[model samples]
Target: MSLFGDDELPPVTARESQLDFWNQVAFERVQAQFKSGSMHHALLLLGPGGIGRETFAQELAQWVLCQNHSQLDSACGSCKSCQLFVAETHPDYHLLAVEDEKTQISVNQVRVLIESMQESAHQSGWKLANISDVAALNQNSYNALLKTLEEPQPQTLLILQAEQLQQVPATIRSRSQLVALSVNEQATIEAWLAERKGGMTEELKLALSLFPQAPYKAEDFANNGDAVKCGDFILDISCLMQGNESPLALAEKWLPDIEDCCLWMLLMMRDLLLLQQANDKSCISLQGQTEALTNIVNILNNQRLMQLNEKIVELRSLLIKKSPVNLSSSWQALLIYCSQLAQKTAKSA
Candidate 1:
């Protein structure tokens, strides 16, 4: 299980194959700042989740700490610093993230990290601290960190990785330089996935479609058979919308992974909405299931699609809050709503 107790894939580390393809430009910019001796004391790396922001931050930390970093900005694995980093025992390097049983990074944790930052580095170089999820920092934590950001220690670098700038406090965001990472081109991601995971299949394609910015996640989903499960879900939902399958049975089949199933439903409904507007198959995410998707799309109007989308979004919000909601009831209601909309659309047609 991952940090969140979910079966999601782990974040890619510095040791993972050379930085993600999309990180090269951002890497070069930082390398230039490093070379010029103008590197920011606090740097914010922002991007969509699962797109390697944390991995890039780790890679930057390693490179900055390496005594014999190459011109190409690669860390020398043989160096003592590199050794400690790879072993995760570097005294000067700290990774602050939310731990188990914690919903957010507490103010106490931030204070502790601030105290550590005040101390001299054990090594003869920069003391590096990486906060993997800045969004998890609450208001008090952010205020505690804002002081440190304003008066950073000498030769210290703090790297913050967050999914978006909006989640960060304006004060903290202003004190740091932002480096945004985006999804690579489709061809680039497909090529990388093909090389890493052997030949590309329909499962891989669909996974890529679902997580276009995070190829590592897409690859993981494909490798772990989640992609196949997603494909089957799309087909099942399509059948249900066409009145060929039972929503109750489908809901029962998906209860084991209700969150993922709901996500798939939202994506399908989004695709249907896109199809209704664009009248094109290219806008959909379920790559090879255009016919099925089109059938589902044709049976629903934009209003019905929007309603289902809203319901799914609300269900997801409830799940995140860990509220006392009956999962089966929520699923049943969602399916019933979709079935009613489909029937209404059919009668109108």
Candidate 2:
């Protein structure tokens, strides 16, 4: 869903940068709790990725650390603390995430962060740590953080964020206050995109259609010409089905975008599988290629299609976990399976 507001929003401000429209309710509740001096030391802001949970955390942190709540719980943006936060030089604030090219947080990182939060704040106010994608914490990382979680420092703030909340252990969940965020409306998100991307174009529609309820992702898709690439992808799948495309070359060409390649393949196979069972477009994500996919679905070996779908799921999971597996050969084999999907039926005939 869209995070930024349209015409209804006031002029730009430091607070505006962090306060996404969909996050207002959660923000207000936290703000009220803070004002009442009953806010918890540790908080788990739970929501799907691209739904503005990160921004919500930032806004909350800025509010808590702001020496002057010059605008009703929003940061003043002029005080020393606000200035330091904006500069990313605040001695009292820390932002933690999975290190670059690495998928999970390390025990050492967790230990260091906990130690920093345990110290006296240089500003003598609040010491804060915002852990993005906290689900990336491994068992050892979690163990390192448990002591601090149980005995949270006074006037300290620890904000944990995760898209897949199930990945978080129940022990951690029980310690922190959880806030689950939801979007305003799909139409509102679309309107915000239209205003920013210059009217509701076909690319915009296709992007949003591809990534439902993930407006930022949709915007990224539109910006990156994935829409055209998707059309190309559909054509390549049809060509492969017709024995006009080589699986080896296709895999090589798609290796750079293997994750999306696998994802699109899965979604397309899903559409094919659905059409095999019933002629339904409502559940189709790649709506633009419905007719093409429907035509392609008619000749393939249905059982092989199901197996290919399953294989894609398995590979996709490996990619999501950043597993150290040989996917190059897997990709080639998967595409070979797809390329020959229609062959079995033809031979049987």
Q: C-alpha displacement of 151 in model 2, angstroms?
A: 2.6
Model 1: worst 10 consecutive residues (lDDT sum): 8-17
Question: Backbone clash tally for model 2?
Answer: 1
**Segments of candidate 2 deviating more than 4 angstroms:** 1-17, 69-71, 100-104, 169-171, 273-291, 301-307
Q: How far off is residue 198 in model 1, in Å?
A: 2.9
Provide the overall lDDT of each model, using Cα atoms, as 2-decimal numbers. Answer: 0.81, 0.81
**Can you write out model 2's per-residue Cα lDDT over 243-312, one digit (the tens) per residue?**
8889899889888889888767876887888887777877776777877787678777577777778888
lDDT for each residue of candidate 1 in 43-105, tens digit (9 for 90 to 100): 898876678887788888888887665443667665668889989999899899998998789
TM-score of 1: 0.78
TM values, all candidates: 0.78, 0.82
